[model samples]
Target chain A: MSAPAKLPRWAELGLLPAVNLVAALLLSGVIIRLIGESPWAALKLLADGAFGSQEAVGYTLYYATNFIFTGLAVAVAYHAGLFNIGAEGQAYIGGLGTGLVCLWLGAWPFWVVLPLAILAGAVGGAAWAFIPGWLQARRGSHIVITTIMFNFIASAVMTWLLVNILIKPGQQSPESREFAANAFMPGLHTLLGKVGLAFTATPLNLAFLLALAASFLVWLLVWRTRWGYALRVAGQNPAAAVYAGILPPRVTIAAMLLSGALAGSLGLNELMGAQHRILLDFPGGAGFVGIAVALMGRNHPVGIFLAAVLFGALMQGGSQLSFDMPRVNRDMVVVIQGLVILFCGALENVARVPLAALLARLRGEKEAE
Target chain B: METYTLIVLLLAATIRVATPLLLAALAGLFSERSGVIALGLEGMMLGAAFAAAAASAVTGSVWLGLGAGIATAVALALLLAFAGVTHRGNQVVAGMAVNIMVAGLGPALALAWFNLGGQTPQLEGAGQRFLALTWPWADAARAAPFPGLLYAELLSGHNLVVYFAAALVPFSAWVLYRTRFGLRLRAVGENPSAVDTAGISVTRLRYQAVMISGVLCGVAGTYLSTAASAGFVRDMTAGKGYLALAALIFGKWRPYPTLGACLLFAFTDALATRLQGVALPLVGVIPVQFILALPYVLTVLLLAGFVGTAVAPKAIGAPYAKEK
Candidate 1:
């Protein structure tokens, strides 16, 4: 076989994303038209509904907050070469932990209760992720299989707990009791009102800032730390990492655990800051949506944040778009998401091959020197 | 005295419950052994179930519906194979795309085509109903001197698909272990490079394996809608496809052992259904959801514990790129 060529410049990597986005939007428009909806009108409605008012912006940010956390969770694992599909399950279990803590022990001051709940959520999420990680690392079991199985197990466990153990009396819904007053995350409405910027009630809270902070932290952790270097090495070339005296299994496990903890905190944010209680479908498809976000972001923290915001806007706007266009389902957002992932995957592959060939050619030149 | 009869009833339920899983797991064995991970089984089953119901409703022929179901599944498998093998897309992502697309598109299409979002019109007439067997010994067992063939009821008296599923276990084992085609397919999965050197097209072999899996998944879907429930419902397969996948892993990706794993989970589901209200011993105290979760929990635990060093087919998820 012929030797591969040299790497493509960074400009090429930058151009590919723009091309993918355009392709995705065009495809989505065609689909909308095929469904007999006015594509332009729908787009207009989407924009108007998502950002027309301060309240809408706040809601979009609130939704973005959850997506940011989950997206970062997924991105972190992807960087480590682990497909952490159990984020949904981990988020649910974490919600349960946060909910229980808030309900029982939230009488403490707000600062104390909030951090404790977040910690509990992270720990719960990490533990949930550790199961599949352990299996993958130690037994060489596939993460995909274990994580998928764990999703069902987690759902069943939550359903059982909701019905029998944690059911709030007289509320027949599959939900836990509301968190105590002190446990609730202070919404933007409260803080903004003090500064006279409040216009309407919006659930966006301190958690959004925390999610942003977490994204920066993840960037640093994945790029700056010695552990991060080991993870990257292990992911890119496991055999090489082993040769370098790194325990790949431990790195894999730690990466997955960290990924899960981030996802778990998404649930905590929703429960304590937005919903103020754990509902059966609280995590919903947000965890899966995070996968799309991570993919679109190319597994970068900043990219994930932007992608999450875009998705969050779509979701928030899509719901309102239903009022203007009654025939279009909110699930059209899912179609858009699917299109994005498809395009992104195709783009990534197309870019990688040429880049790898280019890198190989450069290496050959260096060897000749 | 009646508890003995109840135990017998439970045994009967186990076989009944095991049928679909047996079929689906067998289908998974064919695909995974061929080096393609058939994550689209759930989608295939769902699509088949929809097609089967629609065909049976229109043509009023159970056989026609079953054939349509299988055809739909094959079509989907072909699409997946084309994308994963020919287009060189990531198999897992492509499989997942198929799954999400089918999950969404099936319901929408069902609504558009049949106006049935969840439930289809129930099957009617002799053509629609499954054919059962009646033997003289079986009759004698139920008669005065004895009961009907105790074993026949336990095993034989179901639809033809049940026997077909049970038989496929051994047949698949033979195919995987003894056949030349099976050897080539296994070689393609284990080492596509080696297979390519032998002048066999890895793409063609993997495609064939995936198509076979689709056909089986189609049959499984037919059984689910027509034979099992006599009607179609949205998301009727539920997570059974995933369960079969789990069983495939739990069985360490082998044929016969996978069948056994599927049966074990099916037995638990059947037992859960049977013991829902009856005042039994410790088992009865378990909630239905816990029992429902047992299979998944077992799969995780087994993966974490017993399945040390689970080795997938070497080229399982990699898209085969011929030398340029």
Candidate 2:
């Protein structure tokens, strides 16, 4: 096989990723067909469930909100040459922080609790990332392994907190009691209602707004700011960055803190907005999912946004598919997502050969003409 | 005293629990030494566990179950190796994606075939499970004194997998250090160009390394489902793959060190299991969470404080470029 030749702007920025995504979806379809379900029917259901109705759209967006935070978190770190796999643990700890703040200020108004809880969550998430970040910067320990270990550490800590220490008097399940109504953040339905548009009720809440704002800010920070330039430069070449007066340690620490904070806010959407209670496995697997999102998005803000939406659609739609189709279980949905992750992120190069050949041939023809 | 019995039980449990960790760490040793990190070790182990249990239950043959488990793990390894080593895509991402795929496929396939809540049917009867090996003097041990009892309790009764796990360390050490193939493998991990210049195929070496990783993981998984427990459950490996990776590091990636690290983790695990309720003098009553978290915390500490730029093979996680 020939080496991958560079593609034009559109293909590089768009066509290639789209092809990879389609390849992933097709493989997922084959997996479904192997299980005796019609892939077309599954796709139809997924599309309808994810986008057919207002409520469905709302749920999709709500899931997207968490993904956005996590995707952006992973992207931020990636741009700085760090793979922040600790986002799951960071989100868990961030939710812990959100839960603590909401509990402490249970009687407070929404306005008072919201900002404080967000801050607490950010701090909590950042704190969890700090040790690994510090080690990577100072001790030369690899961040990926340490961050993963931190996930287990966070899970054990969360389990300990939820079960033995905070098991809500006599509740069987290891979840805290619902937070006070005053601590509940406003949902998007209420916000939309205030704006005179009727919308379906959903877990989609002010957290979605926070996530959008974060996306915009990240785009600005990474592309439009001087600090971002330094971070990227450090990622590209640490020696050159140092020669140019950028400190690797400082850049690493800053990027990680920002990444951790964004990841942590993913929990706020669930705990403070939707569930209003902290529980076991609440982050679920969103942190890992963010890796796929960021990879598919190429670590860009707009790319991450679109990627998050697609994954969000898959999740919300997959849930409905499992409910409607007994043959296709939740594990099937996971398989699809896994396929997406594998093709789009891991085996992405599989498509580069033909694409590069085609692109190179077209370029040569144009030059000859 | 009661402490003596507790000590013996804890030691035995330590070996029992350490078996999976040892096998998995040895698996990690192969992959990492050949420069492809097996982050999907968790997924491979979990998938292998489910496959082994399900196959054993269906065929009523422990060997068939082991084969099935090995086949699944090697299949996953092939995917990872193709992506990471051949296509030269990112190794960490490829491994992670494979892990997610395995995590999904194991339960999904289990559900399709068994319909028992993503769990395989229990492995029953004599051939379906690995029976504990009995010593020749077991009858006399029951009738006789403390030494016999100690011998019976400590030396006898572990399943065949434990013995295999024990033997694998020296075997791996011999393969990795004493042979020409081992020399080439280590050379490929440290400097692929040097090996390639010597007319060795780096791709072949790495593929073999990763496949060896797959085989070790299969053994680890079979032990988990067939011997460690009666059947496969969802996420039965828990985080043992990562624990094994940590042990690989804690052992400093050497055969002996890896074994010692697994022992330490297993000992801590046994302590956590045993010391759940008992109060101690110096430390007071330690919480179980602390003990459970001990292995992870130690791994982090080792990475941060003690390792001090000492761990990991050079060129690890890097794709070897043939021309560049």
Candidate No. with top DockQ: 2
**Candidate 2 local lDDT, residue A251:** 91
lDDT of 1 by residue, B1-65 (tens): 46666766676777777777777777777778777887778878887987887788789998999
Please list the residue runs of candidate 2 whose C-alpha ends up more than 4 Å from where it truly belongs after superposition: A1-4, A367-369, B142-145, B307-309
The digit string of per-residue lDDT tens for model 2 on B1-324 reads 466666776888899999999999999999999999879899889888988999999999999999999998998889899998988888888878877777787877777778887888988866999878888886579454467656776788789999999999999999999999898888888999999998999999999999999999999999999999988988788889999999998888899989999999999888988788889999887878788888888888888867443468897998888887
Q: What is the alpha-carbon lDDT for the whole of candidate 1?
A: 0.79
Best by TM-score: 2
| TM-score values for chain B across all models | 0.92, 0.96
TM-score of chain A of 1: 0.91
DockQ, per model, reads: 0.36, 0.60
Report lDDT (CA) for all predictions.
Answer: 0.79, 0.88
**B-chain TM-score of model 1:** 0.92
Lowest-scoring 10 consecutive residues by lDDT in candidate 1 chain B? B142-151
| Per-residue lDDT of model 2, residues A104-181, tens digit only | 798988888888999999999999988889989998889999999999999989998998876787889999988998
